[model samples]
Target: MRVSVVIAAYNAQGYIAEAIESVLGQTVPPDEVIVIDDGSTDGTRSVLERFAGRIVALTQGNSGQAVAVNQGLALARGELIGFCDADDLWTARKQELQLARLERDGELDAVFGKVQQFVSPDVPEQQRARLTPAVEIMPGELKQCMLIRRDALMRIGAFDETLPATFFIAWLGRAKQGGLKTAHVDDIVVRRRLHPGNGGRLHTEAQNLQTLMALRKAIKAQRPPE
Candidate 1:
């Protein structure tokens, strides 16, 4: 099956190229790579232009990641879809392994693997000292670790455009409720980079509130009517 990789970027000029290069260098390269520039006021657009013919680049006005992702999804034409954060890297064999599992299991809607976290190399020693140490490896259900069938994703529906921090969490909750079939592999498919601009770190309070709201919505959806 053909695979399309989508990346949503905002002020990621420092690392976006690495992210795209990783996907381009995958053992099984994606059929297409779509990147949505979410109104970045940096060198990101120029960096994307450097790739030029290699990617389908789209630009929009300061929308959040979910909106950018939705825009990419609308243009994707592959049977299998995968995502890589603008600042993260995918292992070379990520697609090769995930695609094998999906091809073997017709019923599986998505496959995910572990993620390894590391501080970005450009982080200064003093700044890095204040940051949390990297987790060697951890189970990752994040968008970056997923290789999903487009049909199943469509069934789960478009991501919640309102929830900037927990859109994926809310979408995953709905996917589970919809009985989406999924699998996990033991290998690390993504290298999650930690930098000062990391969104999770920047929006902790909002994320926590959104997480609670997503959980409550999931709970309500699963409840039986009287």
Candidate 2:
């Protein structure tokens, strides 16, 4: 099955090229790579222009990651939808491995893999394990490490534009509500770069609090009646 990989970028001049190159280097490349340039005043545009026909570029006012992802989702044409951050790199066999698993088991709607958080220039490899929640609806989960079916994504109504960093919790809730089976690969398929300029890294406490609040609300809303 064909796949569409969407990357939401903002002022990613320093790392956008590597992000794109990683996808291009995939064993089974994506049918298309869509980059949503959310009004980056830096050299983002110039860099994207250099890629030219290699990528499908979409630009808009500086809305946020949610909006950028939604824009890409709306335009995506693949059965399988994948996400990648502008500052991260993917495993060379990411697409091939993920797609093979999906093809083998056609019933899974969402699949995630291991990821390491890169805190500095020398990013060390960290082994991440996947945890399945007992209740199947937990907070503090859902992240930038998976390939999801576009059909399931659309059913969940795309990414929530309301909450920013914590929207993953909401998406997971939606997946639960939709009865989508969650699966994961054991390899470290994605690398999360952490630096001072990174949004969540700079405002860790604030974003964490916001995400916690969002998670609480989702759990309460989904909690069974006592």
Candidate 3:
């Protein structure tokens, strides 16, 4: 199956290249790669330009990740769709293994793997161990660790733009409600970077609260009819 990877970037010059390289180096590289430059003010655009011929790059005014993701998703022509954050890296076999599972179980609409938290090399060795930790990513909240069918994603529709922290979780919850079969792989497939500019830190407590509200609504909506 043809696989497409979407990357939404914003002021990610320092790490976007690494993110793209990781995708390009995947064991079973994606058939299509879409990068949405979400109004990056730094050198991110220039960095993306370096990969002109290799990827389909799009630029738009500052829109949050939800819109950026939708923009890229709309252009994806592959049978399977995946995601990678501009500041995160993926294991070489991520797409290969996840796609294999999805294909093996024809009923499964999506599959996700584990994630490893890692700090940049600039961090001291002593703190690196504590800072960088490996953990399993639960279903209904995984973005980086997921490989989904394009049709399933279209049925779920675009993400809620209002949410900051829980957009992805809410979307995943709906995917379940939509009757999309899902599974998990007991393997690490994403390297989630812990940096200063992470969305968790950028958004405020009030915004985070909105995420909680969104999740509740999504779960409530998924309930069977009384």
Candidate 4:
């Protein structure tokens, strides 16, 4: 199965190259790598230009991560859709293991694994003190940690653009609602950087409110009928 990896970047000049290189280094290389620039004013565009034909580059106004991801999703043409954050690194066997497990479990719709969050120059010493070895999503929560079937993603419908900070939760909720048969892999799929510039670390009040609203929506949907 061909895997299309989509990366949503916004002013990620410092780490974007590393992220792209990690994907390129994958043992089972992806069929295509699509990068959504998201109107970055920094050297992000210049860096992307250097890659040239190596990646499919698309640029839009500074909307948000949700929009950028959706744009890539809309343009994706692979049988399976994968995602990578602009600042995170992927394991070399992320796709190989993912596809192998997928081939093994023919009934599964998606598979996700844990993240290794290590100390980085971007992370402050104080925050590093409380670092954890692994970051796993809760039983009912959804994260873009694995490869999803392209048809399944399209069936889930568009991501909630209003939920800029937490639209992923909503999108995952949609996948679950669509009866997505998901599995948790034991391997490390991603290396999450805990730098000061991490977008989730800098959630504005507005984005936080959107996140809360999205959570409420998910909770409401999951509730049993009265």
Please, what is the TM-score per model?
A: 0.97, 0.86, 0.89, 0.88
Quick one: best lDDT, which candidate?
A: 1
Evaluate all candidate structures by whole-model CA lDDT and list the values in order: 0.94, 0.78, 0.85, 0.82
Off by more than 4 A, model 4? 122-142, 204-207, 219-226
Best by TM-score: 1
Per-residue lDDT tens digits of candidate 1, residues 1-226?
A: 9899999999999999999999999988999999999999999999999999999999999989999999999999999999999999999999999999999999999999999988888988888865555566899999999999999999999999988889999999999889999999899999999888997887789889999998998899889997
Ranked by lDDT, the better of candidates 2 and 4 is: 4
* Candidate 2 lDDT, 51-92, residue by residue in tens: 899889989999888899889888889999988889888878
- Of the pair 2 and 3, which is ahead by lDDT? 3
**How high is the lDDT of residue 55 in model 3?**
94
Predicted candidate 4 versus true structure: per-residue lDDT over 1-226, tens digit per residue: 8889999999989899989989989999999999999999999999888889889999999999889999998888899988888888888988888888988988888888877776567666687665433543332123447788787777788788888788887788767776989887788888877676766666567667877898788888888999
User: In candidate 1, where is summed lDDT lowest over 10 consecutive residues?
Assistant: 127-136
Clashing pairs in model 4, backbone N/Cα/C closer than 3 A = none
lDDT of 3 at 178: 78
Supply candidate 4's per-residue lDDT for 117. Answer: 71
Model 2, residue 45: C-alpha shift (Å): 0.9
Listed per candidate, the RMSD to the true structure in angstroms reads 1.1, 5.9, 2.8, 2.9
lDDT tens digits by residue: candidate 3, 1-226:
9999999999999899999999999989999889999999999999999998999999999988888998898899999999999999999999888988998999998898888776776666776665554552433236878899988888888888777467887787777777878888888899888755766755668667977888788877868889
